[model samples]
Target chain A: MRYSKYFLIIIILLSVFNLYAEKPFKYVETGVNTNSWALIPAGEFHFGQHQHIKNIDYDFEIMITDVTNEQYANYLNEALEKGTIYAKKDTIWGYHPGDPFDAYLHEWEIPAGDYPHMPINEPGLRLNYENGKFSPKAGYENHPMVEVSWFGAKAYADYYGYRLPTELEWEKAARGTGTNDYPWGNTVKRNQANFISSHNLFAKMFGDVVKTTPVGFYNGNNYDGYQTVEGISPYGLYDMAGNVYQWTGDDHPKVHYRYMRGGSYQSYEYNLRVWPRNSAGPEYTSMSLGFRCARDID
Target chain B: MVEWGVKDITVKLLGLDLESVERSGRIIMLYHVIAMIVTSIEVYMITSIVPMRKHQRTNINATITVGWITAMIFGMAFAYFGHNYFYHGLFLVGQSLIFFAGILLAVTLNPWNKHFLVENKEYAHTKNGYDLERIAFFVMTVSMLISAGFGAVTGSFWSNGHETFLAEDLIRQPDKTALQKSIIGYLHIMLTLIAIAITLIVGRWMDFKGKLHKFAMPIMIFGTLVISGGVWSVVWTHMAHTFIYIGSTFVMFAALLLVIYAWGKLIKDRIKEQGLKNPSFGQKFVALFHDPIKFGPFWQMVFMNFTVSGVGIFMAVKLEEIFRVWPAREERITLTGHWHIPAALIATIILMYYIDIAGIKGKLRKWLGWTIIIGSDIAFAAMTIMSMKRLFVTEYYQTPLVNWTMLATDFGLGIILILLAGVLGWRLIDLFRSDNRWSKESASPELELERTAVLTKQGRDVIKKEMEI
Candidate 1:
C-alpha cells in the first residue's frame, strides 16, 4: 500500500508539469524567413571593444532585426498546428529535455519537464492568445518580440534549426574586427539607439509607458523629418548593440541562466557598448528584453 | 484641475475660499481624457500622417492591443477608486502601452526609411520648407513620457495628498508641495505639447513659409526641451525659481517665433498686394482673420500659448506666495480661468479644423468658423480682464462691473460650446442619414478624385504661367 501511494504521488507531480508533453522528436529544419541570414566570415575579430580578441572557426549567419511579435505569433500558430507545443493555463509550453544537470550547487534537474515557451499574458505583452489562437497586437507586429522567456526565444530558434549565438559570437558580430564603442562607430548620439532618455520618438510618443522601438529602427533613414542612423555591425548584422537584448546560448556548468547581449530600450548608452553584458534565468521575461537567432553557415 | 468628486456640484457651486489650483484632479482628468479621447485621436493622426507599411501597421495594432486591456483596467480603477493608488497603478500601465504605440507610430511615419524622399529629389528642401511636422510629432511623444513621469511620481509618492476626494480642497494643503509641484510640471509640459501639435497642423494647412519657418523649428525644439528638463527638475526641487525663469523665457521665445512666422506671412501678403492691380486689402485682411481654405490671422492668435504657459509656470512657482495673499473670491476664479482660457483655445482649433474638412457650404462654414474664432477670443479676453482684477486695488476688483464680466464670459463660452455641439451634432446626423449623393464619405472616391484632378490642372497652369513670365 505504501509503495502504491508513493507511485500515485509521483504520477500527480509529473502530470502537473505535463511531463509527457508531445515533442516533435523530429528535426524542424530551416526558419520562417530562410533568406534573411547575413554571413560573418570565419576569422578572428577583436571582440568587446577590443578589450580582448576572440575567434570563430566557422562562418555563421545571423538576422538583421530582432525576432518580432508578428514572427513569434506566426510561429506560435504553426507550432500549435504541428503539435510541437501545447497551450495550458494561458501558457505555450513544449517538451525540451536538453540540459544535463549534475547536482552542482543551486542546480536543478528533471527527467522530462514541460518547459513553458511563453506565458500568453504579461504586462506590456505584444502578443495575445485568445480563442485558441495567438496573434500579434495590431501596430506592434514589427516591434521586437518581448515579454518572452529565454526558453521561448530558444524554442523559436530550435524550430528553425537556428541557435542563439553564444556571447563571444555576438561580440564578434557587433564589434566586427574593430574596437568601436557602438555597433555603428566609436561615438554615439542621443538617437543612435533606442536607449532610455534618448528622446527618440518612441520615448516621446509613449511617455514613460512604452519604451521599445521597432527592429532595425536605427537603420539610416529619416522617419518623417527625424533622421536616424543605422546601427549595423560590419558583418552586415543590424541591431547588434541596441533595440532589445538578444538572448545568447551560454549555459554555464550548473546555472539555468542564458546570456543576453545588446542593451535594450530601457538601457543607457553605456549599456549599449559592444563589450557590456546582462543575464537572466532562462524562464525570465520582460517588456524590455527580446532575442534574435543565428545559424552556422551552410 | 477642479475635482468633480462631489456628485452634483455645478460650476455655480465653486467654493469661495479654495486656495490653490487643484492638480490631482487634473491628473485624473487627463488620465481620463487620454484613454477616452487622445489615444484614438493620436492613432488617427499617426495613420493620417505616416505612410506606413502593412507590417508596421500590424505592429502598431499590437501596441494598441495591450492598450485596450490597460484602458479597461483603468476604467474600473478610476470609476471605483478615483482617490486611491489603484487608479494610479493602472494609469501607469496604460501610459506605457499608449506611449509605446505613439513611438512606434512616429518611427513608421518617418519617410527616410521608405526612401521616398531620396527617390523624389523634390521631396526635400522644398521652396516652402522641410516637412518638419513629423519631428514635432516625435517631440510631442517625448513630452507625453515626461509629463506622465511627473504625474506618476506625484500620484505614487504622495498618494496621501490625493486621498482627499472632496471637491473643495482646490488642493490647497501646504503639506502636498511635492504632489502639487510635480503635477503642475506635468500639466505645463503637456500643454506645451498641445500647442506644438496645433502649430504644426496650422502651419501645414496655411503653407507657412520663409526663413522664419526654419528658425521656428530649431528654436521651438530647444525651447520645448529646456522647458521639459527645467520643469521636471523643479519638481525635484532643484533651484525651482531659476529653472522656472529659464524655462519660461525659452518657451515664450519659442511662442514668439511662431507669432513672428505668422506675422511674416501677413507682411509678405501686404507687400505682394502693393504690386497688385486692385490691391484687395479689405478682402485679404478679412481672409487673414478667418479663412478656412487658406492662411489666417488666427495663427497670430495662437500666441495665447505663451500666456497660458506663463500662467502655468507662475502658478507653480508662486503657489506659496499666492497662497499667502489670502486670495479673495474673484482671484480664485482668475486661477480657474487660467486653465479655462487654454481649454477654450484647443476646442476652438478643433472646430476650425472640422469646418475645414466637413465640406459644409462655404458661407455656412465661414459663419461657424468665425463664430468660434471671434467668440473664443472674446471669452478669453474677458477672462484675461477678470484675472487682472487681482492686480487692481482690492476694492476695484469687487466692483459690480468685474463680477458681471466674469459671469458674462463664463456663460458666453458655455453658450458658444453648446452652439458648436448642436451644429456639429446635427451635421453628423445629417451626414449619417444622408443619401450617398451628398455625404463626404460617399464622395471620397470618384468625386474627390475629380476634384483633385481639377486642382492639379489649375496648379500646373499657374506654374506654366509663372514659367512664361
Candidate 2:
C-alpha cells in the first residue's frame, strides 16, 4: 500500500510539471477571454514573388480567427478604464513607436456623436459606446472587428501582451509550408471563400447579405464537436484567405503604407491568393479591414 | 469668382460635407458646367453657320463630324463620372444632360441638303478657304496639345491617387516615387505631341491627290485602333493618368480624321460613283435608316440617346430618396413617363417605316405623320409638366433652390425638344408627299429628273459631259 501511494504521488507531480511547462505554447492565454490561437512551427516559408521573393523563417502562435468585435471592445474598454490608452473622438491619431514597418502616423477616430447604440448582443451594432460602456454590434459579437486603424489594432495587441503578425509570419501561416496559391490549394473555388463574382450579377446588384459571413461560416470540419478542419490553413489557422484584410507588420517599400494580407469579402478571387500583396495607408479604415494578433513562442 | 462661390454653395446645399464641397466636389461641378456651356456654344455655331450653297454640303458634313466628336466627349465624361462619382446625384444629372444634349444636337444639325456639294463647287480648293481652314485646324490642334500637356503635368491622369473629400477616410498620398510620376508625365506629353504631329501631317496631306491620301486613310484608322487599345490597357492596369492622356490622344486623332473627311471630302469623293450622284434628301434619310450599322455618326448618336435616357431614369429611381424631387405619386408618374416616351417614339418610327414601305400615299401618309407629331408632343408636354411640378409644386424638395437649378434647366430643355420634334415631323411629311415608294427602279429616274430641274444650265452641262464620258 505504501508503494502504490508513492507511485500515485509521483504521477500527480509529473502532471503538474507538464501543465506548467506547456503553458506558454498553449493556444489560449490564461485569464484572457480571447479565441484560441494556432501554432506556426518554426520553419522557412517562400515569401512574396516577382521582385519581392525571398525565404523567410518564423516561429509564432497566431489567432485561429481574426480578432472578434466583442474581444476588441472588451480590450478597448479595459484599456480606457485603466488609463493605459486614450481615445480622441472624431480623430484618428496614434502610432507604434518601435514598429519596423514605418507605417505613417495618421488620425482615424470614429466620428464623434455618431456611435450607434444597441444591446451588446445585436448583430449590426458595429462599434458603439454608450453610458460608459463599449460594445460590439449586438448579434455580431462573433464577427471580425473592422474599421480599426492600424494603430488601433497595434494598441489592442500591445495591451494584450501580443503583437501584430509580421508579413512573413502572416504569409507562412496562410500558405503553410507548401507553395499553394490559396489555403485550399492552387485552384480557387467559389465555395472556398467569399468574393465578388462576375457570374452572379443579380446578387452583386442587390448587394448580398453574405458579404461578410460569420467567422468559420465555411470550410470548417468539426471533429469531436470542435472545429478542427475545413477551410483551415496548413498551420490550422481559420480564415487565412478571406473574411477581412488582416494588417501585417510590414510596410510597402515605396510608401508610408502598411502591408495587408489575405483578402476581404469584397476582394476578387485572384486577390485572395497567398502570393498577392496589397497595402493601404496605416490610417485607412473600412468595414472590410481587421487584424489578427500573434505572439512569439518563447 | 462670385460664380465660383455660388457653385460652392450649390454643392454645400446638395448635402455634401463642407470639406468635400471645398475640395474635389466644387472643381468637378465647375468642369461639368463648363463642358455643358462649351458644347452648347459649339452646337449653336455649327447650326448657325450656313456656308454658301456650294459649300453647304461640306458644312453639313462638318456639322455631322463635329456632332460625333462632341458625342464622344460626352461619352467619355459620362464614363469618367460614372466610374468615379456615381453616388453623387447632381453630377450624375449633369453628365446625363451633357450626353442627352449631344444626341439632340446631332439629330437636329444632321446634314440634309442634297445639292450642297454641287452648289459649293466654286469654294473648293480656293487658296483663301484653304488658308482659313488651315489656320483653324492649327489653332484647334495647338489648343488640344496644350490642354493635354497641362492635364498630364497636373497629375490629372493620376486619378487613382487623387484626394477627395468623401474619400478622406482613406488618404492616398501622392505616388511614392518621383521616377514613376515623371515617367507617366513624360509618356503623356510624348503621346500628345505625336497626336499633334499626326494631325498636322494628315491635314496637310488631305489637300494633295497622290500617295499620301492613299496612305492617310489606313494610317489614321490603324493609329486610332492602336491608341484605343492603349486606353483600354491603362484603364485595365489602373494607370489612371495614362488612361486620360491616351484617351485624349485618341480623341485628337479622331477629330483630325473627321476634319479631313468633312471639309476635304477625301473619303466621300473617292467613293463617289455615277449611280450615287444627286441622291434626294429622302433617299439619303432612308439609306441612313436602312443601314444604321454602317453610319458611324448616326449609330453613335443612337447609342448616346439610349444611354442617356436609360441612365437618367435609373438615377432618378435609384436616388429618389436622396434627391427628394417629387412625392411618391409624381415620382412614379415621372418614371413611367420617362420610359414610355422613348418607347412610344421608337414604335412610331417603326410604324411609319412600314407604312412607307407598303407604299401608303396621299392623306393617309400625312395623317400618320400628324398623328406621330401630336402623340410625341403630348408625351413631351406631360414629361415637362411633371418635371415642373416636381420642381415647383412638390412638397418634398429636400435641396435648396440653388441646388434645384439643374432640374429647372432640364425643364427648359423640354421646349427645345418639342420644337425639334415638330421639325422632324414636318420633314417626314415632306418625305411622304414627295415619293410614296422607295423602289430603286422608281427612285433613279425621279432623282435624275429632280437633278435636271434643280441644276443651273452650267451644272446640267457638266452632268451631261460626265455622262458622255
Candidate 3:
C-alpha cells in the first residue's frame, strides 16, 4: 500500500513534467499581406455614401479584407451544393406577366454544384474564377478568383449562409475611419497602387497582360497600413481604391450598370477614385473585378 | 499618520469614469494586509501545532513549516519589488533547499537503511534504500521548478509588460501612439494568454490526480500570485489605474481567500481534532481564530475555493473587456469568459467528497450531489450572463453601488455552493475518520485502496511537476 502511494506520486510527477514541456500548434504562413484586415479597436466611425448621402448615416461592421480564396471557397462550396438562396426578389408581385422563368432566376444558376449563390451581376462573384474560365492557365489558388457574376457572388454567399456586403458595410470597410476618395487617400500615386496610371488602354493585350498580384502585395506603401494594399480607411478595409472594383448589394441609377467601386488593375487612374461609380452587365465577368465579404455582429 | 500608498495608474491609462485610483489602491492594500496576516498565522500553526500532536509525522510538519515560511517571505519580497525574475529565483532556491532536506530526512530516518542495504551485501534479497516518497518529492520538486521556469520564460504573462524591466529604450506605456500602441497591445495580450495557459496546466494537474489536496495547493499559489500582482498594480501604476485597481483587487482578494480557505482543512485538523479533543468552546474558538483557514481547508474548503475562484474568474473576464478592447474584432475572437471549467472542477471535487461518505448512500446521495452540481452550473451560467450584460450593454447602467451589489450576489451564490460542497466533504471526511469497516470497503478495499493510494502519490508528484511548484 505504501509502495503504491509512491508509484502514484511518480506517475503524477511525470504527467506534470510532460504538460510543462508541451508547445502549441503553429498557424501556416500564407504569405498574404494582412494590412487590409488590420483590427480596428472597438469604437464608432461614420458610415454612408460619402458624396451622395452626406447627411444620412447607416452604421455597420465592415470586414478588414475581402473574402479571400480560402474563406470564399468554403462558402461557395457549402451554399451552392445545398441550394439555399438568401435573396428572393423584393418586388411586390411574384413576377411580370410576360417574364420567362423569372428575371432573378435567369440571372442566377443556383444548381447543386455548378453555380455560385450571389446575384448574377454582383461584383463579389467577379472574383470566383478558376484556371481557364476567367484567365489563361495562370490561376493560383491563393490569388483572388475573377469572372463570377454578381448573382453568382450573392448566391454563393447566400448558399453558405452569408450575404453580400451592404453598401454601408462595404464602404465602411473599404474607407475605414477616413473619407478618402480612394482606399489610400484623397491623392493617388502611380507606384503605390496597381491601377493603369499611364492611361494607355492598348498598352497590353488581355492574355499577354500583367496579371493581378495577390492582395496586400503593395501593403508597404498603404497610406494607413490599417486597411489594404494601398492602406488606411475609415473602417479599415484593404484594396478599396485600385486592386479591383467591388460590387455592393445596392443598385444605383448613376451607375446604370451594377455599381463597382475600387478601380481594377486595368482601370484608368480616374476610375480609382472611391466616389467614381461604374458597373458591368450580369453575364460579363472580367479579370479586373473582385469583392470582399462581411458578416453581421449578432 | 498616512501609510505609503501606491499610485492609481490603472485609471489613468484605462480611462475609467468611475472610482478614483487612490481609494481603490487603499482597499487593495487592506486586502493584502489581511491575506498576509492570515498566511503568517497559518505558517505559525503548521510549525507549532501539527507536530505537537501527530508525533509520527513531526519531521514532515517541521520541514513543511520551514519551507512554507521561507517561500512566503521570498514570495512577498518578490511581489513588493514587482520583479518576477527575482521572485522566481528566490522561489527556486527555497524549494531546492526543502527538497534536499526532505531527501536527507527520508534516508536518515529510514530504519531499514541502517540495518540492511548499505551495511550488508551478503543478503541477496536486500535492496538499495530507495524511498519512493523521497524520490517522488525530489522529482516532483525539481519538476515543479523546471515547469515554473519554462512557464516564466516562454509564458505570455511573464513576457507581458516585462519589457518595463527589459531595456531603457523600449517604452512600456499604457497608452502610446497608435503605431506603438498596436505593437505593445499585441505583445501584452499574447503574454497574458500564455499565463492563462500555464494556469490551465495547474488545473489539468489537479484533474489528473483526482485528489483535492494536491491540486488545491497549486491553485492557491497561483491565485495568490495573481491576486498579489493585481493588488500591486492597482496601487503602484498610473495607467488604467482605477478600473484595473478595483477589478484586480476583487480578483486578488478572491484568490487569496480561496487559498486560505483550502488551507483551512489543515487548520481544521489542527483545531477540531488534534489540539486535545473535547476542549472548551473558548479554546476551540481561540484556535480557530489563530490558526484560521488561511493555509488549509475548512470543512467546506473545496467548495469555497471553487465558488470564489469561479466567480472571481468570471468577473475578471468582464473587467478585462471593460479596460481593453480587442484589436481583432473583425476576426470575432474575443478572449474572455473561460471560468466555467474551473467552477465545474470545483463542484466535482465537492461532489466526490460526498461520494466518499457513508452517510450519503445509494441513489439519494448521488442524486443530491448531482443536483447540487447541476444547480451550481446553472448559477455559474447566470453569473456569466449577468456579468456580460453588465459590461457590454450600455443600457444597463451599473453604478458602483449596483456593481458592488452584483459582486456581493456572486459571493453569496458562491457561499451557498460552498455550503452544499461542505455537506459532501464533511460527510466524506467523517466517513474516512470513522472506524466504519463497511464504509472503508465501499470507498476502496485492500488492493484497490493500495492502488488508489499509490496512484494518488504519483499523481501528486506529476501535479507538482505540472505546477512548476
Candidate 4:
C-alpha cells in the first residue's frame, strides 16, 4: 500500500511537470510557388543605417520578394497529382479550399499541378499591357503580373503548396540596402520609377496619352545604371516601388485585410513611399496589383 | 522539543500579559504532549486490560477515564492557541498515539502466536492483559518529541514576545527568518517519516498476522491522511480558509472512525478475556448461505449492465462525432440514434438471465452462496472501472447527464470498495478462527462420534462389575 501511494504521487508530480514544460510551435515552409526557390540561408544584411530599432540591431538575410503566383500554382498541381491533399492542407490550412471558378463561371476546377490558368479580361486581371493581348502596347510577359487578391494569392499559394510571406519579410525587402523610404534614400523623384505623375495609364490617339510604360522603359532617369532600369528595389529588385502595388500575404487584424506594396501608375508620391501600407481584402483584385515570391530556409 | 506537561498556564503568574505568542506556543506544545500520552495510555489499556485477573479492571477503567479527561483538556487548550496551530497539534498528537497503538495491536494479536491455528495450546492459555508497554512508551516518547519539535519550529516565526490570542494573526506573517523556515522544513520531513513508518509496520503486520479486517483499512487511511496533512501543513497552513478548515474537520472525523475501529478489534479478539473457541466449517460456511440467501450475482449483473450500456452508448456516439464519422444532426435525430438500441437490448437480456437463474430455489440451494461472494467482488472491480470511465466522459462533455453520472459512479465505487473490504475481512477472520487440527477425531465429528460409541460398548462389562456393590 505504501509503495503504491508513493508511486502514484511520483506519477502525478511527473505529469504536472510535463504540463509546465515549454511547447515547440510548429510551422511549415513552402513559399507561394510550385518550383522550389533557392534556400536563402539566414545571415546578416545591410538594412537602413541608424533608422532601425537601436540598441538591439542585426542585419538579417530575408526572402527578397513576396511568394509568387507561378511557384504556388506548380505546388498545387504536384500535390493533387500525388494524392497528397491531406498533407498539402494539414501543413497549411486545417481544411481544404474549394476549387477556383473559371472565366465563364460555368464550372469550378481544381487546378492541375503547376498549370494555373490566369483568368482573362476580368476587371482585376493583370494585363500584359505591352502586348495588349493582341496589340503591341506597353508592359509584356517579362513584367511582373498584377491584379491578384490577398485571399486568392494565399489560396493559390497553398494550392501549389507554399506559404505567404510574413509582415516582417515584406518589411525587410521594402527597407532595401538603405534606411531611406522609397528604396531611394528618402527621395521621391519622377526620374526614379513609373508613377501617375511620370507614366501614362492609357496611350490613346490623344495628346499626352495616359498608359502603362513598357517594363524597364524608364531609361532616361536611371538612378542606378545597372543591367536594367526596372530591376532596382534600392535593395536591387526590378520595379519594387512603382510597378503595380504588389499583394503581400501579411494580415493585420485591425485592418481586417493584408497589404499591397509598390505604388500603381495612378498613385501619388505618398503611395509610392516604400513604407506606405495599404489594406486589401483577400478577394480584392485590380489591374495594378501583383506579387513577388520569397523562399524560407533553416 | 520535549514537552512533559502543562506549565506557566496562569497568564498573570508569568509576570507578563496573556498576549504573548511565545507563551502561547509553549502552552500549546505542552498540552499536545500531555494529551498524546493520555490517549496512548487509553489505547494501551484497551489491549492490555483484556484477559486480566479479576482485580485489574478497576485500574484499567481509571486509566481510561483519566485518558478521556486529558483529551478534553487538550481540546480546550486548542481554543487558546490559534485554531490552525491547535488542530495541527491535536492531529499530530492523536495520529501518533493511534499509530503506536495500531502497531502494538498488530504485534500482540498476530495469529502466528498459535502457529496460525485457532486451537493451538497457547491460544487457550494466553487469555488477555497482553502488555506492549515497552513499545508503546518508545513510540509515545518519540512521537511527542517529534511533534513538539515540529510545532516549535513551525510556530517560531509567529512567536514574537507576546501571547497572541488571534489564530489568524499568528499565521499571517510571511517574512520568516531562514532559521525558522528550515525548522518548518524539517518538521514536514519528520511527520512524513513517522506516517510512513506507521504504515509499513501495520502493513507488514496485516500480511503476517491476517488482521486485514481489524487493521489494514485504518492503517491505509492513517498513513494517507497524515502524509497529506504534513504536506499541507508545510505548504498551506495560513492559506487554508473556512472551506478548507471544514473539509479538514471531515477528514479528521474519518480518522476518528479508524481509531474506533481499532478499539472494536481489541474487544472482538477477546484479548482481555478467554479467547473465543473455534467454530466448525459447516457452522460457519452454512451461515453464509442460510437465510435471505444473498444472490448478489443478480444485483451485480444489474449494475454491470447499467454501467456498460450507459458508457458504451455515450462513447460510441461521442467518439463517432470526434472522428467525423457520425451522421449529420438531422440524420442522427431520425436514423442513426437507433444504433445504440442493440447494445441496450443485449444488456437487458444479460440482466434477465441473471435474475431468472438466481430466482430458482434449486439453483439458489446449489450455487447461490458462492455466486453472491464472487459476483459482488467482480461487480466491485467493474464498478471502479465504470467510475473512471464516467470521469473521462465528463472531462470531455460538460453536459448535465455526464456530470451527474460521474458523481454517482464515483460515490458508488467508493461504497463498493468499502463494503467488499468488509466482507473479505469477515471471511478472513472466519478462516483464522476455524479449527485447523489434523487429528482424525478433531477433523471429522461424524467419525469421532462413531469411535466414542464403540468404546462405550467395549467398556460396558467392566462398567457393570464396578457398579455391582
- Against the native chain B, each candidate's TM-score is 0.69, 0.26, 0.31, 0.26
Interface RMSD of the predictions, in order shown? 27.5, 21.9, 24.5, 31.4
Q: Which candidate, 1 or 3, has the higher lDDT?
A: 1
Query: What is the model-wide C-alpha lDDT for candidate 4?
Result: 0.39
Candidate 2: residue B408 Cα off by (Å): 27
Between candidates 3 and 4, which one is better according to TM-score? 3
Looking only at chain B, model 1 earns a TM-score of: 0.69
Classify candidate 3 by CAPRI docking class. incorrect
lDDT of each: 0.60, 0.48, 0.40, 0.39
- lDDT by residue (B1-469, candidate 1, tens digit) is 1122332243236432211222334445444554434444445434433334445666776676677567656644454343455665675676667667767776765523322222222222223332444454556566666676676666565445354222222333223366666766676667656655665555544444456555565565566666677777765665765765675576556556656666556555655655645546665565355444233335424536444656666656665344333222223455666655665576566556555655666677767665665566666776776665545534212334455666777676876677688866777677666463245532331211100001234435655787799
**lDDT (tens digit, per residue) of candidate 3 on B264-349:** 43345557566576767676555554421121122223343344445555645654343222111101111223333343443344
lDDT of model 1, residue B440:
52
The full ranking of all candidates by lDDT, starting with the best, is: 1, 2, 3, 4
* Candidate 3 stretches greater than 4 Å from native: A1-59, A80-139, A198-208, A221-230, A252-257, B1-469
In CAPRI terms, where does candidate 2 land? Answer: incorrect
**Candidate closest to the true structure, highest lDDT:** 1
Which is the better candidate, 1 or 2, if ranked by lDDT?
1
Lowest summed lDDT across 10 adjacent residues in model 4 chain A is found at: A128-137
Q: Write the per-residue lDDT of candidate 2 for residues B144-180, one digit (tens) a residue.
A: 3333333335344344664322111112343334424
User: Which of candidates 1 and 2 is the stronger one according to TM-score?
Assistant: 1
